[model samples]
Target: MTTNNIDILGLAEINVNKNMLRILEHMVQDKFKLYFTTEGKKGTGIRFLVKKEFAVYVQQFQHFEGRIGFIDFYTKKKKIRIIQAYINVQDKEKPQVKRLYKQIEHWTNQCLNSFVKDIIIMGDFNTKWNEYEFLDISHWRHDIFNYFKKHFIKESTLVFCDDISDMYTYIPNNPNHSHNKIDYIWCNIDLMLSAIDSKPRDVQPVIKTDHRMITLDLFMDDIVINKNNTQKCQPSSKTIYCYDEMQKTDGEWNWDKFNKDIIEYLDNPNIKLTTNKIRGINSHKQLNQLWNLFRKAIIHSAKCNIKQKKMKVKQNCHPLYDSDLKRDLNMLKGMLNKIHGTKLDFNDRSIENRQKIIAHITALYRRSDGNKSNTLSDFISITKRHNIIISNHFLHNKTFQYKDILQDTIIILESKYINATYEYKKNIMNTFIQERNQNYKTDKKKMIKSVLEQPHTSLSIDKVYKNDNNKDTFYTEENEVKEQTNLHFQMIVSAINCEKDLSQHPKWQDQYQSKHDVQHTIYSDLMK
Candidate 1:
């Protein structure tokens, strides 16, 4: 719990059945800024705990009506958006379930439209498929994966590294339920490649939740540098100060006051100095000693000039924070929690009436004295008294589609290529088997001739070899060909449609060459 490994943590299924909210708040109080989004029902909610420094850069916090939300914040001076979602394990074919999927897509599409290119789509998706989960699937989940893939995003768990093996992030503690790798962290491919290590920590209970924490470790420099190639506005020069009022004063030169105050303090009867102590000290040491004596005198004189009441007030407590309304408000919230529980129902008429009464009482208490206290009760009372009229504004709000409309040509060509490749491979494999069986009784020379006569069959489907030399020639090495083909496909799709350079992109490289040396190097740094 005291480790320094994580900067941001996303948790799903907070199990609102228990007192997880208050417990979690206490657990991460001093270290993290905990934000929770729930439907205010049992067993539903997603929480994000971000470090305090990182929370300062947060520009937007969008909370949805379901178990999904996103926080767009800055880290390393780069505005990175992190979206966390929790898909319920239910009948996926249901209309409501399909609508949930659409909600995720709509939110993600909105994120992609933002200026921040480095986005992380992560959390408990509740899917079983692991390998190429985002690409090969053709169900309701397919839409989510396809959108990421088409936009050149890649799964962090799939990136090849010796330390990261295929393992499940979710394992029910109850022995009857089997483990599954449902939780995931999908980062922009470029951002993942720079990772020193990226994988799930372990399938363990965190705050009694049923999912493990996924970790991504990268160099600090990699996160801070802006590689998006976009112009950014300069940060504003503003200072926030919280200091004692005695330390602040507006005045012109007051040398006479300074000298008189200083001389009076230094000339007091209590002042004493040893002759031997001064005799033993050198010029440089003497100057420091004299300055310290004079500084103490100035401080003591300034303190004495302030009245007793003002000094006592400054010494005892903050002038702004002490109030009777605040005390009543705190007491009221504690009483409500004890009586009704942590989950308050704002929609219930009985509960709403009680809340209104409490607000009125607190407002009366604040108004009794001339003290200005912006208590929660004051706001509630004001809200009840004044309602903003939105008569015609609702008519203009239309249902505009947020789904990405991909180019027709790109979709047609991509579909054709996939189908063609599948068919070609199936036909070639069938022909190869038939020819080998048919030529069982043939001689070695004839068999060789028959196999060679078989129309062009090669494992490198995209590569073409020329018959220039007498010696047998083959396509490039297995790894090289695969890399080339992967790169080519990424380039074609990302270039023409997505406006992304796939070959040079970090995410693309991690996807195809997951087992490459660069990935190994990334994990090596993490291990160190």
Candidate 2:
């Protein structure tokens, strides 16, 4: 499906069960709209996943699981139906094989019985027209091939092949056995005429499966037009699949409706809400049980009242697609070609396949190794290059002794942010400082060290200021000198309150000074 673009794709001989399909649906739920078969067992079951873009066009789909499936596309003109059939036989007359074709014939008629006329039947027929190297298949092929021919249908892939070897879809593991041309694409003459190749093409087994992925170039004549916007939808072009239809089902999940429905459902007496289902939520095990019940209740209410809204497409979508109902045989002349415009490739397997094969192997390699120097420089590789002749030739007759370059680079930036060559500026600054100091001498008398016990004001909390030698700030809150003075005052105040019993406590010691002693000491510092 990936070698070329495809709008709708169906798989045969897949063994995915319903449970497994649900898991796969969740993984790709955002991308594809999945459809399943009615067959109970998993073996050889058919599965269809329409791409989100064209899923809007899928009006209806039905399948018998492992046997046969058909999907109807709602085209602008009429409906176009595509059937996927997987019929396996042992090359012998059997009622089971006949019954399968009877079912297929019935399904084909069902597609034609309604408004659907342009029907495409494709899949693994699992049997060639001839057995022993295209010998004859009149006995069995007559019924099947001629039956489709009545409606102007023909095999799109194998019948047109000059040699089966050029396009063998399925190859058996046993090398000795002949490869088979069992897979095919059969379509209505109206749709076939619009095909780019008419005859389906085959891409080699880049895939791991034994069956070579067959392809067809279809719906090439049309273009997507919206007012002034035009999307050149080539298979190789990066196409933006519009999933608005699939994702916008019923518009969006309505919380109001959901809540109302849940409340009503819980109140309904007919629906039992017993202790078995209403498991307690006290412990981990009970909580898990309760969670399961809660989820089920939500799901039940959701099904009853919460279908959002279906997206609608205007009939006047494209004038190219418009046609009168009272047409002759040319009604479907270009309908199939127009379908190639969008969403039909929703089932393309390449979308998933592309994720696995990281597209730009070389680009990733270059990015990670971008910094590496593949060609090493000679001077740079050496341990020492202080004397490397940089710009030697350009400087002087192929000699790179550069004064301006070295002078700008090799400057002493010791304590200063910038380099300066003026030693006179430094001497002038020193003379000015000495002049200022001489002027300040004897200008004011300096206060001698005295009982300047504490700082007059407290520091603000906006920011803390500290000097390099402020050791007490490291241990506690105050400066070392201020802390000691504060402690001395605290002891004096305590001693004054209990002067008679000051000696009774060892903590007070005998250093409790009296008022006369304090007055004498305080005056001495003031006098100094």
Query: Each model's TM-score?
Result: 0.40, 0.41
The TM-score of candidate 1 is: 0.40
Model 2: per-residue Cα lDDT over 1-528, one tens digit each: 323456567777777667888888898778778877745554467767777776787888777636788888765544667788777665663565687778778877865443235677878877764562456545663466667878657676644466555456777889998776777787765455456653434444443566755555565342112334555543432323232222222445555666766777566564446676455335788666655756777888656545434444333432122322112112222222323332233234464533322121112222254663211121122202333344423322311222222222222111121112134346677986675566556432221111233435544332232344654232234465465444556666465423356667765654544455465667557634
Model 1 Cα lDDT, one tens digit per residue, 190-276 = 456456777777533344556777777766665654456555653344332222323224433234554567887777654545577
Scored by Cα lDDT, where does model 1 land?
0.58
Backbone clash numbers for all candidates listed:
2, 12
Q: For candidate 1, which ten residues in a row score worst on lDDT?
A: 398-407
- lDDT (Cα) of model 2: 0.53
